[model samples]
Every structure is written in structure tokens, then in C-alpha cells.
Target: MKYFLPATLSAYLARTYLVAFLQLLGVLLSIVYLFDTVEILRRAAKFENVSLLLVLEMGLLKLPEVGQIILPFAILFSALYTFWFLARRHELVILRAAGLSVWQFLAPIIGVAMMIGVFHMTVINPISAMLISRYQAMEANYLEEKESTVAVGEQGLWLRQRTAEGGVILHASKVQMPEWKLSGVTVFYFSKEGDFLRRLDAGTAVIENASWVFNNAIVNSKGRAPERIARESLPTNLTVNEIEESFSTPEQTPFWVLPSYIRTMEATGFDSRKLRIHFQSLLAQPLLFAAMVILAATVSLRMARFQATALMIGSGVVIGFLVFFASSFLKALGASDQIPVLVAAWFPPVIALFLGMSVILTTEDG
Candidate 1:
């Protein structure tokens, strides 16, 4: 019992160190890939076909979002890899023979996993959220400037309308397709050259199957006399449907608002599968990390004399890959409503836990 901490700590340190290193490498690689892709798109956006500093900034900001998804699998694979090597070198066997149970051997790894979960939830997720928000802003600023129509965010809503005469920033606060009315509206009209022209704020704007009707609107026209008009009757060439199509999707709601965002999205009768799956998956992360440790122990721990360690290591690597892809596929299935979100989110860790336990039992009895 007294020796348990030292042994576990040693193993945890080795395992987590390898995991962190691999994950960092993966993150850097992803950053490079994202940078190149973003650069290509940004160049296309430029008249001279050149990328700007803001484009690079946007890429850098997007890296954390990519890392949030990739780091967990990297940690899992790294553990498997490190453990396989330790087993191949016969360290696991020596440890087991030295009166350490497999559970004891895994204790440190599990601890590391828990730490990772906490770090991800408390630190990495928030950081990724901030980066994603920043990236979205940068992307919108870059895009709406060039395109006549721009899609912002994932919901295929909140579009931008550009014209040779002027540009408009259209905000669709809420859309009621059944009533053909858009509630809570704000529009920013810019000069033909993109200078600020006027801003229109409306409450309960409606599209009456034809023209747009602005209710209780305040129009602030800039330049010249700098006039302000407030009236119940406002006419515009912008239609409700057209304005709704012009703003970026409301799906761009900040990550900090995910709880309320999820609720609001669900209430709106939208398919909440993706968000549900993501939230459930977030809740399952600690278990997933814990399962990874158990899996590493089961695959890498020596149970039989004269066993082919190389073969076992290879098997562990294969199994790790299978688990990773299987989890991802299940996540996709859940998002598409082909499976229950809870099942998709929780099954991977549950399945891994069972398999690892089975392996541990098999080894111990033999």
C-alpha cells in the first residue's frame, strides 16, 4: 500500500508525458493544415490574391477549436503507444511480479485521465470557445466585404447582402416561417463604397408575402443633415425573407451561451441532435479518459510467460484506432438521429470499460 503511490505516480508521469507530447504534436500539425487551407481561401478573397495578417490571426484563433476535438484521442493513442512499448520491454511484467496488481498499475493512469478531463472542461473548452468566437468575427469581417451573399455560422442563417449601390448588415432576431414574420430586426446600410450610410432598428418586422413592413422603427441616417426618423410606418426595398437570409445564422451564438442556446434551439423545434450529442459527449469525457487508462493497462500488461510482446503491442495499436473511429462514427450517427445521443456519447467509454475489465480478469485468472 505504501509503495502504491510511487509506482502509480511513476507510471502516470510516463503515460501522461507521452500523451501530452503526442497531443501537442497533433495540435501543431492541425494548425499547419488549417493555416494552409485558410490561406488559400483568404487569397481567393483578395483582389491581388494575397493573404492578410487578419487571415493568419483567424487561423491561429481556430487552432484551439480543432485541438479541443483532437486532444482526447491523441491522449488515448499516446497512452496505448507508451504502454505497448513498456510491455514490449517487459516492464509491465516486472511490475506485476513485483506485487503490483493491474488496478494498482492503472491507478496513476486513471488519475492522469481525470486531470485531463478537468483541464479540458475547465481550461481547454473555454479557450477553444473564445478562439472560435474570434475566428467567426474575423471570418465574417473578411467574407461579407467581398461576397454579395454570405453565409455565416452553421445554421445557414444570418446572411450578408452586398450590392454595387450599398451594403446591409441584416440581423434576424427570430424568424417565424409559419407567420412569415421576422421579429427583432436591425439593419445597417453602407454606402456603395462601404461607408456607413444609415442604421435601421425595428421591432416585429413582418414580410406580408410580398413587401417588408417595419413596426416601430427608428431610422438614423448619417451624413448631410444627420436625420433621425421614428415612425410606425417604414418602407424598404429589403424584404423580411431577404433580410433573414442576409444575416449570419443565429447559430453563431457564443459558446458561453451554449446552455441557453441549446434550450432555445430545442424550443424552436430545431433538430438538437448535434448539440445534444456534443453536450452528452462533454459529460462523458471523464469516463472516456478513465476508460483509456484501463484500456492501456489491459492491452499492455503482461499475463503469460513467453508471450509475443510485439504482437500484443500491435494489437493494442489496432484496438486503439478502432475505438477512436468507432466513437467518432457513433457521434456522427447520434448527430444524424440514427442513434440516441446518450448512447452515442456514452457507449464508447462503457464499451471500453467492459473490454478492459474483461482483459484484466482474463489476465489475473491465468
Candidate 2:
């Protein structure tokens, strides 16, 4: 049985990986195509250079970002397929007859799920962050060099601010959700609201405990300032949530930053439901995947006793989808305050786990 564990686990992992990679690749490519087409259409309408190669490049660059978003679903569906295949082949029956318990069968899938969770959090997510950042930069340069000065891109809002001290140019490339922090920001101050007050730029900016901490600020307050303080610090009463609210998109912040971001938002008297739900989603993903594997195994493992592959697979898929839908519904309900966020987050996984357990137990007892 101990020797059997490694072989069974390896087989399950291989099957899950193959299914997940294929499905995710297809889903991401489709999304990239649509995104690229929309951008090309927008540029061509303006009589700009929207070349075929440019569209291809944009699609290629955006796929990794989409992959990160779809990873959880990929894992779930892949596990389902693997377990279904195993049951359909009667391999599960053989294992059980050889005294392999349901828990033993599940150990490998659990291990794989943990590995995938770590991979998503560290490796895949960073790739998504980098690709998204590059995409914004390219889009920004394109907008700045080609069209109107006040135009916006896929990144976020860009504007010019005028004050007694001088004229300031603001570029906020991305906004963190729920509590709003700005990413890839640049602020320029001018003398007499025309020439320049100074240049202050940061890779990222957030309001923490009421003060704006500019990360990697580059300042140049050089010249024409009888009223202006030269080499002076810029003052802002903006909370992190406020700055985050100003950005139009939520994809700018890395997943690792959302926890602290939510804390910053709540501290500043902001609603963090959306961010909270997204955070909860991270934990729910692996559990959901585990349940899916169990459900698939239960259905497929009984093929020798029940010659209904099509019916079984169809029912299993429907059950999988229902589990997903139930989760989204519960999340929406929780977000509206009808249910607790924690309950909503765990509802799908818990329900699925019990359902899988009950089914396996009934079959074994019968």
C-alpha cells in the first residue's frame, strides 16, 4: 500500500497537469485574442499603426496574466478529468479491492493541490504581474506619443493638476481595489503652474495610517521659487484607500499585497468586501480542487459496477458546475451582508467535501 501510494500519486499528478495545462491554454488564448482585437480596433479607428504583428505580440504578452486568473478553475477541472478517467478504467476498484482507502487515494491529490497553490502564489503570479506591468507601459507610451494629451489607456487615468506652487502632471498606471492605492505613479510639479515645481516619481504609492509613503521617490524641485520651498517634501492627507479608488483597474496590485491593502482600506473607513472576497478566494481554491478530485474519483471508480460512462461523466460535470455556481452565489450573498464572508468563502468547499464523503461512504457500506 505504501509503494502503491507513490505510483498512484504520480499518475494522478500527471493526468491533472495535462488536463489543466491544455484547458488553461485554450481559455487564455481566447481571451488574449479578444483583448488584442479590441485594442487593434480602437487604434485603427484613430488611423494609428495597428499592425498584425502588434496584435499578435499583445496577445502573447497578455496570456500569462490571464493564466493566473484562471489557474484555480484549471486545477479544479483537471482534477475532475483525472479522477473520472481513473474510475472509468476500474483502476479505483482494483485499488479498493487491494485495501486502498479513500483517504489513501486522496493523499497524492492533496499534495499536488498544495504544490499548485504555492506555484500560483509565487511563480505564476509574479509572471502575471510583470506581463501586466509591461503591457501598461507599452500602452501608456503609445497613448502619449500618438494621440491627445488627456487620453487614457488600459492602465488607468492620467491628468495634469494646476496649483499656486506650479503645474503638476500625474500619471497613475494602476489602482488597487477596495482600498485604492496607486501603482506605477509619476507626479511632476512646476514653477508658476507652467514651467515646473519638481518631479516626484515612484514605482508604487500607498496611504498607510493617514500619510502617503512614496516608494522610490525621485524629486527635483529646482528653480524659480520665492514662495515654493526648494527640495521640500510633498504633503498629502490622502489615505491608501483614496489613492486606490482613483485608479480604474484592480489588476495592478499583486495578490500578495491584497491582505495588507485590505487592512489599509478598513483602517481608513473604506468598504473592503470586494477585496475580502478575492482574498478568501485564494484559500477556497485548493479545497475546491480537492473536493473535485474526490467527486471525480467516486464516479469513475465504480465503472465495473455501472456501465454508464457518459451519464456518470455528465452528471459529475454538472455537479462540478453546480458547486462552482453555488460558491459564486454564496459569495454574492455574503458581499451583500446576508451571510458572513468567512461562511460564504468556505461554503462551496465544505458542501462539496461532505457530498463526496457521503457518496464514498455509502458506496463502501453498501
Per-prediction TM-score to the true structure, in the order listed? 0.68, 0.63
lDDT of 2 by residue, 1-366 (tens): 353466745676555656665675587568766876676557645536656666566666666666655555566556656666666677667767877776776677766765677666656665676677666555545533422133234445465544446555666676565445667777777677277556777776665554445676666567633232222334454444434344323355567777776665554444667668767866676677677666765675564357676776676668767876898799888878788888888888878878887887888642
Q: After superposition, how far is residue 12 of candidate 2 from its true place, in Å?
A: 6.6
Per-model CA lDDT versus the true structure: 0.64, 0.62
Cα lDDT tens digits, model 1, 280-336, are: 777788888788777766655552234656665576567668788989899889877
Error of 1 at 213 (Å): 10
Give the TM-score (vs. native) of candidate 2. Answer: 0.63
Lowest summed lDDT window (length 10), candidate 1? 150-159
**Evaluated with lDDT, which candidate comes out highest?**
1
- In angstroms, give how far residue 199 of model 2 lies from its true place: 13
